[model samples]
Each structure stands twice: as C-alpha cells, then as structure tokens.
Target: MSRLKLPHNPKLLSHWEGWENATVYSTEGNSVLVQTVDMITPILDDPYDFGQVVAANAISDIYTMGCLPELALNIIAFPCSVLPKVVLSQILAGGQDKAEEAGVLIGGGHTVEDDELKYGMVVTGFGTKDNLWRVGGAKNGDVLILTKPIGTGIISTALKAGEATLETINIVAESMKKLNNLPVLLKNHKIKINACTDVTGFGLMVHALSLINKSKLGIKIVAREIPIFKKANELALSGFVPGGAYRNQEWASPRVIINATPAKMPFDPILLFDPQTSGGLLVAVEEKNAELLLNILKEAGFSATSIIGSLVVDKEERIEII
Candidate 1:
C-alpha cells in the first residue's frame, strides 16, 4: 500500500500535517490565515441532518486556534439526477443553522454535479491579537488535557454500519454535536495554556508529535488515566476503525513506543489513528495551573477532560503510551 498511487504534489506533502491551518508564513506582519473546505459522500445518506454536524467539524480548526469566524462558504457535489434540489436546500438549511449557532456568516460557494452526494463548509476566522497556541509552545513539565471523549471515530463507523446501540450512538453524537465552547471558558480564566491543538485525523499521538517536535521534549503518558468515550474499547475490539488511523500510526510510530501490550492496549492502534472530523482541544498548560484550568473546563460542562500525561524531559520526543 505504501506504493499505492495517489495525489502527488509538493503542496500536499508540505502541508500534510494539520498545522497548515494554524501556521503563519509572511513578512510585513500580515500573517496567513487557515481556511478549509471538505466534503464526504461517505456520510451522504444523512446529509440533511449531518450538515449541521459537519459544518461544526469544518469550523472546529478555527475554534482550536482561539480564532473567531468572519465568514463561511458552502460546497456541494451531488448527483443531479438522483438527488433533488429540495434535499440540497434542506442540507443548506441545516448547515446555516449550525453556522449561526457558532456566530458565523455564510457567504457564497460552489457546487457541481457528480456521481455521489457530498457536503461540507469553508470557514475563515480572525486570530487573537497577540496570541496563537501553536504546538511548538508546549513546554516540559506542562500537563496535557483533552476536552472531549475519544472513540467518536469508532462510534461513527459503527453507526453507519448499524452495529452500535442507540445509547452508544447518542453518546458519540452528543460529543460530536457539542461546539466545544472552550474559548468562552478559557477567556474567563487567568491561567495561560502553553500549547493547544485539536485532535483530529492524527489521533492523540500525531497531534502530540507536533507538540513534542516544537518543544524538543519527551512525553510520559499514563494510558489508564486517559479519558475515553463509553464503548470505545468495545468498538476497537470489533475492529470498526476508520482508515486515517493507520496513516497516523505510520507518521507517529517512530517517535513513540507502545508501553502497553497488544492485549492490554486500551483501543486499537488503528482506531487511535482514525481521522476525527471535529474533536477535542488538546491543551498543554503550565503545571502550577493545570488543575485550575481543568476545574474551569469542568464548570463549563466538559467534565470528561483529564490530566492524561506530562512532558518528562528533553529526550528525542519519545512516548511511553502507557
């Protein structure tokens, strides 16, 4: 599969890491901004309903960077013969509703006829005047905190296949539907976060790798202490993992060692690498105030947040998964 032919271009190779959205490149202080547009025919059947959820997914990167939205654009690819304009309108309505909830305005976008149905958004936002929490900011001894439960990747795949229960599906749905709203809570707190990144397609390790490389440090994680969504383990056992996870494993494996045995692994490494549409904020905060920040997140209703690990020392960015 490594030799599998796929899209090949320097732009894709250079920005393959999620940082394309948050990194800046320029002179004259006119910093570049991050904006993205993505659509999934895989989730097409529920387009009208999933539009809102997916809209949020597209906006999440902006939120993770503490940026406020300025505008949005709708993108669509649908089979004109098979799907009606009415269906497309309803999908737009759903996306509009979610965009408004996030306090963003939808401008205009493009649409084209295709063999399958696809839908998503393009979101643009402004950065904080003096701050941008790039992964490089993470410092040694800082504590790691994750805001949402893991395993939504497995849960979503399960739902698509009708293998998950209403309760399990609902739990995953709620986690996905929630807007994170971390900025509201974070703005009110006096404490500062050294680094922050959203855990998406890369899973925990890939995202953590960015923080590690930027800071030049090693991480010690207590796998048992990490917070995972209900039934995540169950889904992992069933092998309902998404494909993006394997890519992440390949990228992150060299920097880390699986401290736990395969049998003892909390979730499938494949599932761990699954691509998340919109996931939780992975925050690295100063040790002295990590607890205070957790309490703030707790008060804001993200009770699942936890202190899963800490930067141990400057040692080639090795990870002890357990």
Candidate 2:
C-alpha cells in the first residue's frame, strides 16, 4: 500500500504517517479529524458479546488519539443462511449499545453475506491539534502508564481449545468489552500526555516500540510490574498461546532487550508479546505527574492501571525489559 503512487495531501499530519490511525486536518483547520477502520473475527461464542468487543476494539483507535468518537458505520459479514435472523439482530443490537455507551451514533451500516462471521466499525472523531496524541511524542524520563491488563490473546486461544474455564472466559470477555475512555478522565486533570497508543494485535512490546521510533530514546519496562490476567500465563505455558503471539515475539525480539530473567516463571516472555483485543491505552507523561495521573485513573475505576515503564536515552535499543 505504501508503494502505490498516490497524490499527496499536505493537510495530513506527517507525524502520524505510519501510525495505525490517520489524522487529517479539516478544511477550516480549526479542528483535526481522526478516522480509523477496524474489524475482527469472532473471538467469543455469543454473537452479542462478540459485537460488543468488536465495537470497543474499533473505537479504541480514536480514543488512543485523545479524541471522542462521534460517528460510526458498522461493517459486518455473516452467514445468514446458516444462522438465524435473531443472531444477526442480536449482534447488531450489541454493537449499537456499545457505540451508544461511547456517546457515538450508529447512524447506518453495511452488511455482506459470507461463510465466516466478522464484525467491526469505521469510526470518526474530532479533536484540536494541541490536544491530539500520537505515537511519537515521548520524551526522556517520561513515565509510561498502562490502563489495563494484558493476556487477552492467550485467554482467547485457550477458549478455542476448550481449556479455559467459564469464569476465565467471562473475565476476558468483560475486559475486551470495556471501553478505554481514559481520555475523558485525563481531560479533567489537565495532565500533559506526551504520547499515547492502544495496545492491540501488535502486543505491548511492539506498540511501545512504536512510541520511541527514531526519537533517540528507549523504553525500560519493569516486567514484574506488568499486569496479566489470572490464568493467562498458565494457559500460555500450556501451549494455549495464539499464533499472533509468536509473530509479535518474532517482530519485537531484536528490538527488545530483557535485562533480568524471571525465576521459575513459565511463559513470562509471552506476556510482553501477547496480542490483545480491546486493550488499554499506554500513555507517556512526565515523571513528576505520573502518580497524579495514575491516581486519577484509579479514582475513575481503572484499578488495573499501572506505571509499568519509562523512557530513557538509550541509543542501542528501543526497549529494555527488566
């Protein structure tokens, strides 16, 4: 896609050129528009729950940019002939409810017939350039805060193998369905977010690397402080790791350097490379205000939030796990 000869638009923000979501300036230039489209296959059995997860995952990109999603269009592909109409209705209803929860309107959508079921949305949001967050603004000595726990990928893989218990499945589903609305909370505190990105399919290591690319800085992640799901590590060690996890490890291993080896830990490395669904927002803020920002997040009900890492002026590597 990058090689295709396309006309250049100067209004597009170059800082976000390689970013997952696209940010473009409006004609009036008073506000910037953030647009992103994402779709995911069913990770759970219930269509309604799947809808909720997909909607949350899709809108997460906009939220990562510190913008509020206002409009969305559903993108769905389902096997209508094999499934009941009620199933489709339930899925659509679930997506609508989640969108409404985010204060977004699902005005219209498009659907197509397919053998495998898939669902997601194309979301649009608005924000001023001064408030917009991108993947590349982390400064040295900035503390990194993760808004949620990791390990959704391993849990989903366990579900597919019938190795995950009902309680575990419910926990993972609930996390995936939870919206990353941290931007709203940050607004009230007036904290300066230096950089921000949502942990998604690329896993934490890869996503964190994106924050420090060519910035003459590196991220030092405290592995012990990183949060994981209840049984996610056990499942990952038992070979319930998803294929995407391995892919993430392969892509990030060279750029990542682990200083301290965890003792008697099984699949400890997988936690850093575990692909996530609707994961939390990883924000970089000045070390001075890190605690206040974290407190605000916890007060807002984000109990899993943690200061997992910080940015350093390391020239050799992009990430150092210790």
Candidate 3:
C-alpha cells in the first residue's frame, strides 16, 4: 500500500539521506553519535507495561549503534477520548520508569488527538565512530547473529484479535522489553562484526536487505538456526500473522528469496518481514569471534541469541534464505 501510493499528499523532505552522507564523525567523550526514536500505539493490555516497552524500545537504537544516551524526548499521539485519563497516566508512568531504568531522561514531548495510540522515546547518545556498527560492512564469511527471538508481530496481532494466549503475550513482551545492549559489551571483543541493525518493522529480511544492498552481498540462513518465540510460528501458520509481515514482503520482494519449500516452513517468509514493535538486533560478525560476541551478548542478557546466517558477495544484490 505504501509503495504503490502516497499515504497522503507526500510533503517535501529536507533531511533526506542525512545519515548516509555523514562521515568523520566524533562525539563528546569520544562517543559515536547515536539517535533513535521509537513509538507504537498502546499494544499491551497493561498501560504501564506499554509505556515501559515503548520507552525502552525507543532508546534501543542507541544501544544497537553502540552509544550511551545523554537524553531523550517522548513522542506520543493518542485518542484521549477513547482512552481514559488513568490509562494515559499509566502509559506515561511506564514510559518514565523504562527511561529511569536505562538511566536516561524522557524530559518531555508532544501529544495530539490521534485515532490510534502511539508512544515511544527519542534517544541521543554518543560513542566513537570506530565503534559504530553499521549494516554496510557485512562481509563474506561473517556470521549473522540475532539477539532475541522473532515473532512479536504475529503474537501481537493475535492479541489484537483476542486470539493470543496470555502466556504468549507474556513471552513476547519480555522479548520486546529486552534492550539490545550488545554494542557496549562488544566494544572490546575479539569478534569483528561487519554490519548491524535493530530488526523492527522491516523484519529480519528487509533490514538484512540494507546490508546486502550496500555490501553487494546475499544472506543465507539455516532454517534451524533462526530463533523464534515458542508459539509464534504456530500462530503465524494459523493465520494470526500481522499486516506488517505482508507489507514487508511486498516492499522487499525483489531482495529476498526463501529457499525452503513452502510446505516445510509456510509462514517463514512472512515472519521474516513482520513488523516488530521492539525486536532484537542483527549483527554480521566474522566467524572467528562469533562465539565471543555471542557470549558478551549473553552476559548483557540476550539469552536467546543465535548465529542465524552468513553473508556472501552477490552481483544479484539480494537476500537468499536457505
């Protein structure tokens, strides 16, 4: 839908490609500049939990990019009429608590009467450019790692439809709330990760495309290597997958090819593109120290981590899932 037509009269943009051109970057305290904003309509049944997850997710980019945030501003939009003030308050409180846990300030933000609820934070942090992890450096022989299990989109969709189990919601929320802090932990590791990014709305496939597009590489994943939530695959096959998954496949179709027979893993491709509210980080690291990096991530609390794939130079410019 987005690719075929403008959501509305598309406005002209001025800050086009700001991130791609910046170079010679430096920061106070020798930090690499990292900025990230995250928000989503209130997804959790518990308003407080919603707030906490949104705030933590918004700041995840700083963690993924290898920096400690100095501060952040809240970004939110919601329907006050549809939602009670108490619900709203719980959301804010939860957001504030998440920020406090991360030792960053939410400070303040804007709100509007939106049809749907949305909440998140904008985080600005700093780190050395030398430590900046990017998705363009994925080299052949680099091992790919997923810091958390996939399937937040599917589980949440089921929740919205009143079809998801409480156990599933609890499990998915735990994964979403888990922040990706491997950057700081990987600072002194022997592992050499070539590319990295937080897997969110674009799903593992679309985000991986960014790396393949820039590095002229294709990614290969072992079906058994990719980690998934306990019942996520089950839900997806039961037709509980989210809309974002379809959108992802539609937008990134040219770049991805799923090799598994549809019979073996029916919703695998859909899962690859499902929009994750607060998904995990994917890093392409050299195999020599892949274990060490995974160890550090585990120490940092990414317990479900796994080496999912490898990158290969490809003139075709795509993701080859095997």
Q: All candidates' lDDT scores?
A: 0.72, 0.86, 0.75
Candidate 1 wrongly placed segments (more than 4 Å): 1-20, 23-34, 41-45, 261-266
TM-score of each: 0.85, 0.95, 0.87
Clashes of 3: 6
Question: 181-218 in candidate 2: lDDT tens per residue?
Answer: 87777776778889999999999999999898878899
lDDT tens digits by residue: candidate 3, 27-135: 4554455566666876779888888888777877777665666688887787888988888888889888877877787778888888888887777776676666665
- Residue-by-residue lDDT tens digits, candidate 1, 127-229: 5435555656778788998887777777787777788888886666666666765665667667776778777767887877777774568888777666788
Better of 2 and 3 by TM-score: 2
10 residues in a row with least lDDT, candidate 3:
12-21
**Considering lDDT, which of the candidate structures 2 and 3 is the better prediction for this target?**
2
How does candidate 2 score on lDDT?
Answer: 0.86
In model 2, what is the error at residue 2, expressed in angstroms?
Answer: 4.4
Find the candidate with the highest TM-score and give its number.
2
TM-score of 2: 0.95
